[model samples]
Target chain A: MPKRRKCLPCLSGLALLAGALLVAPVSAAPKRVMSLNLCTDQLAMTLAGPDQLVSVSFLAREPGLSMLHEEARSYPANHGLAEEVFLENPDLVVTGTYSLHNTTALLKRLGFHVEEFSFAQTLETIPGEVRRMGALIGQEKRAQAIADDFTRELETIAAGQCGKDPTMIAYDQNGIASGRGTLADSVMQAAGFANLAADMGVIGVAPFPLEQVIAAHPDVISIGAPQKAPTLGEFVTRHPAIGALPDTRIGAFVPEASLSCGIPSVIEAVRALAALRTEIAPCHGNAAQ
Target chain B: MKLCMSLILLVFVLFVVSLLVGPAELRVEDSIAGLFAGGSEAAAIIMREIRLPRALLGLAIGMSLGLSGAVLQGFLRNPLAEPGVIGVSSMAALGAVLVFYSGLAGSSLYALPAGALIGALLAILVLLAIAARQGSTLTLILAGVALSSLAGALTALVLNLSPNPFASYEIIFWLLGSLKDRSMEHVALALPLMAAGWFLIALSARAIDALSLGEEAASSLGISMSLTRFLIVAGVALCVGAATAVTGTIGFIGLVIPHLIRPLTNRMPSSLLLPAGLGGAALLLAADIAARIVLPAGELNVGVLTALIGAPFFLWLVVRARREML
Candidate 1:
């Protein structure tokens, strides 16, 4: 009973320390966090707890490309202007290093706590990104959980691949195609398909000649879903030439916005595409047939 | 007749050069084979689908600009009365922008011609109304400047409102013009309308020549003023509209060619038409070839070259017109 009695003060003292630890950093947990880039918006939204994220880039509100568009509406939006960043007075700012080099430089000059996510991120880097964002927002445990789940789910999807390795090309608007070193190329590989555009010596995104696309004769062509408004660039996707190809599965296979960036939601893209991969060119021949 | 034939020859030579020059260096034999006999499939697509359509469009659109310019100069009785000058091409660009970007006609190529034709017709009507009433050189030129800026502004607005980022980028193409990567589909869309324009302009040939001798004198010589006006308006609208629909607004071909080749002709409006048309083709083809060769990869917009050549020519025209008026 005396030993049991000592446990109370020890537990109370420990509780006091735990309370101090939680409240002290919780108070420091940036009152206003802002995202200046699309990819960072995805990471910040997923990792940050409720009300922790103050605003996201205006592009996040666009349904065509944003995975968490509904969640994005609750928060205010920023146009990635340095003045807006200063006005909002965000303790921490997140953005990609692709564009707005001047804004990033200016923000650094003004002594803002800025974290830059690289643009050339592949599937392998996504889990780390989730964890890193979690750490930034003082929600390390939640981020670790998301990172583990993302990694595990990715593995599960990767494990399901039968290695039939059907060829696919990420054909986009205006006859552009994603080649090697692009996220699409990595996604195709992870889903047990070869990127035909990459195989033909195309590096990064480039103009894919319609004739070459026909000549390569890929098994699948992944096109981005067209937006609500029309564009002549979409004609290449629906051209009679592309339609003429036999035994080809052409579509926005992984659903819109899934493969647009390297987010945890991209696991769904992989899962959906992995399912498609099995159906099209299954290792267990009789089962697929 | 000999000058006409030689001008035609120059156009033909430039046409061949246009086909020959591209980012893809097909051997002459391969290019000829691709154009005629379908040598290698790659060469064939490059020549036929990519370069052939571009070259053919160059020939046809160049002819249309020349023809329109010639006809406008003759009908309006003003040297500065080209489609781009008086806002016909700019209005047509606005029409094409409104229809294509608004998706009212869907993603069809026909939308371009449909919208552009309407725009050109409206511009012609407005200009004709102005010309028929006052018809002073200064008045007509000022009206044209106003129309061009208005149409240009509206075209820019439409493109800016367009959800497609690429559509906004196309503002440069509309204002400046280019013939790069034009397909046979575009050739199909524009050529027939332009040919009809040529025929209609040809029908008004004798009338324009007669009308050039002051409106009263020409009309007294058995010319129906209303019918002549209609033909000129419709003809210029069709040619310029169809041309702008495909190639965007290529300026100064009409202005410079007529003035240059008029000296070669007997100075009659009717006589100047054929030579002006041929010279326009030659100038446009040469410029387009230079456009391709200049950058090699990101080919210069042919309109940029035409403007570079045309803008200086235009300033000179202004100075000379002032001197002659004085």
Candidate 2:
């Protein structure tokens, strides 16, 4: 009887230890996180809370591609140089696998806890990505809540999309357009528009003939926001040919740089374009706002 | 004059060819209707906006190179003295690079011609000073070679330093030229300056003919040396600068066209000017047509085509010169 009494105390102590280990994530989260990719910078910035993220990639400051460029200024920026990353001595590092292979590989060899995200971003990837990043930054519960809200909102927008699918092409710098398997293509599909470039057998960024674009005459021509700097390539976008398409609505329909990567911020682009599509080609009179 | 007239006709045909040929493959009827009748908006947009500017730029830029070639050869009295050979085009490219890539002009198209003119003017003044100090053909050519290399290097440096990531890719635009999608704005920017250059070159015609008799003999014939030099220098700078600002340094058009057509003309540098300009226009228009036709989708740089034709011809000239010297 005495032995059984002693066994109960020991068993309860073991259970208490296991419970403490289960809760370790909140206590054991890295204090300083560094993002070496622009896309990761967006996710980490949203989830890392104040004073948690130590630095972002230098590209985070660029207004053309970074959504949180202003917020990124408060943190130090890395140039993807190994020496710099090592010097920062971050508890964890994040980057994209598509680029900076050498730096990432080198950091891995030096025993740094590095995480790499793929560049093949799509609308479906954002919610899960937000949750994954949240777990990495020790904000899992907050991440799950944010992720669920995002999914609910995305579903709400998708539900409103009618059978009327307007064709659109994302004409970017130098007459290039996003084809199938691109973030822009995925965004187009989600926003109730068909990607004409992808339909034309374009698999990635490829030059589309001006004549082809004119002849096809999609309902909307989505374009990148013009950089303040001038280039001969920009001439393709501002061509009088594109402007003269009377029936087509052409503009920066997507928010600036939102479609650059697949992330929660891309929801802004999706929502804007969904609303515009509804305006230009309504499913029915009832669909009109 | 008859030869000049024929060259102009050829230039016209090539200009039309440049308009008709592109990735789009517009039918002849649609193209003509688009050009004049505005019957189809798509065709009209292509004809008026895309092709018109390219054709116009080809014509104007071609004329500038040919005219400058004739003038530089005559003024220097050196058979090898085309704009690229004497560093004017490359220097002007350097100038455009400085202003355009530096974002000094705030990425405005106007900055290209403005910077190019200044660069051309400086290059011409320096070359003229060198020629004045030593009229020997070898010294001037050697000096030109040095300046061109230096300018070329600096242009690459400036482009690499640009804030835009895409700016580095545009080094090809500076080194070898292309006029793929030149807009009317390009035409508006360069045509006036080129026209002014032609007028100045025309004024110095009689003086150049006299100088062919040798500098002293020409001067004794009541030709004011300083005035003639000024006209030719200013004229060449303005035309070549404006042309290069838009098209990049298109080599050999200035060099090969004049030499090829000079024999057919009266052989007097003054008499060769008009034919050379016409010939230059035809050659560039043809090359631009070929640039599109040859690759179709991956359009060959017009400068590359011109260089291909010009480089061999340049070699032949060098060989012939060496033999004559021996």
Candidate 3:
């Protein structure tokens, strides 16, 4: 009877240890997070605690594509390969629903905790995404701070928009333009500018005719900066017809790598456009006012 | 004379049509006024900077290809000789792709013509050597096919290897040329080289006619074969290289135009050159116009339209050539 009583305490101790193991994952934040998508990489970089994010997609370091490319250098870069994920065995994996389809599936099948962010991001979704990434990485307070700042700043810019809404087109390489339902379109809207490509019935990223772009005579033509490597497609953006718009302001008004993704940092793009709007057509003594 | 006059009129009409047709639906009166009077700055830019360059490229590039094809067929004494069919255009495209994409000349449009000229020059030299060694038309054509396949594969490989992701998208442009978004800069880059090419080819007109009789007979006629060879080689290379540098590898204009015009002419190779050039300009302008009209948003590649017409014609020519051989 005394031996049974001693064994009872040991059995309960083992049960408590097993229950703690079950509860720990639900309570604690992931220590090692790997981001296999460019957009997710930025989110994780912005929200992750020190040493929390183990690796980011290699594209995160590319200055042309990543707004936080400078910060991305400190974190190790992954090529979004399944093999690397297997080797690294990060506690959490964040990727995009649009790409790395097989890797996402494989990771999920292998019983890894995977979170997917949608590629079709807009200004409205930015705060939600920031908070979600923050929650996932246990940086909710920091994420909430950034998310609130982005929302407040965006709202302030949108509120200041009045009077003349200058027409703009985010013309990219190969005569492509960001139109309706694109992040650039939403940014232009918040900045008090009409998206010319969207107004002309273009959807998403589509080839906007050069002649049409010329004929539209937008008040501003926002073009991408030339890529690090030269491309013939870049010439379309620099075509003389676009240059001939004497009244139209043509330049990379948006900061580099700012408009390519929908992150909290995209607030910078909206702020720049709003400043341009103030310069081009101020709200003071305007008809809309 | 009548054929030349008709071809001239056709080219003139097509040139105007090419200017008139575009994705922008400008009023005819407005377009003309914009081209000359600058009524609306937008219209003026579209007319001057956009449509004009595209139309001019269509005309000049077509002429270059046609003249080269006529000169090549006469010099080689092979009806099947053409820049695109014989892989000269493909090699020229490869050269341009390699030079421009490699940043060898720092993104200057001049790099395109420079590389293309060298590529076209090498191709012509190799083809000329093959033609000299084996007088058979089929052997020369087979060699051209091999060269074309190799050049095409290499062009794709180089583009794929480029550090710029957009460079790979240009593979289609390099393979199937497009005149979309061509500006005055492109015309400035290509026209002078092509004009020089035309002049050089015109210089060898009498020699190619003489060579039509046979290489031995031409030599006996006191025609300088070496000089003629140099002029023809340089001429074809420049014409095709410059055209391709701007427009990518636009196939079949060289092949189809000469054949189409030869029947209208007295069958003299020199006589075919002028008419072929004019006809080529008209056909290319028409094709380009069609390209703009067919799918106004994206626009079809001008090469796609030309190949559609030329590939069928090539098959027919091959069959006829085979029957003649039999």
* Best model per DockQ: 3
- Number of the candidate with higher TM-score, 1 or 3: 3
Q: How many backbone clashes does candidate 2 have?
A: 0
Query: Order the candidates by TM-score, highest first — what do you get?
Result: 3, 2, 1
lDDT of 2 by residue, A1-289 (tens): 8999989989999999768644554668888898999999988998888899988989988888888889889888888789988898988888898989999999989988787888888888888888878877798988898888878888888888776699999997668899988888988888889899999889978889776788688899988777776666776777778887878988888877787777777889889999997787677857543
Give the Cα error of residue B294 in candidate 1, in Å: 2.5
Model 2 residue B162 lDDT?
Answer: 72
Q: Residue A218 lDDT in model 3?
A: 92
- Per-residue lDDT for B209 in model 2? 93
TM-score of each: 0.84, 0.91, 0.95
- Residue B5's C-alpha lDDT in candidate 3? 89
User: In candidate 3, which residue pairs clash?
Assistant: none
Native contacts kept, each candidate = 0.23, 0.36, 0.89
The local distance difference test score of each candidate is 0.83, 0.86, 0.91
Best by lDDT: 3
DockQ of 1: 0.21
Q: What C-alpha lDDT does candidate 1 achieve relative to the native structure?
A: 0.83
Instruction: Look at candidate 2 and give me any clashing residue pairs.
Output: none
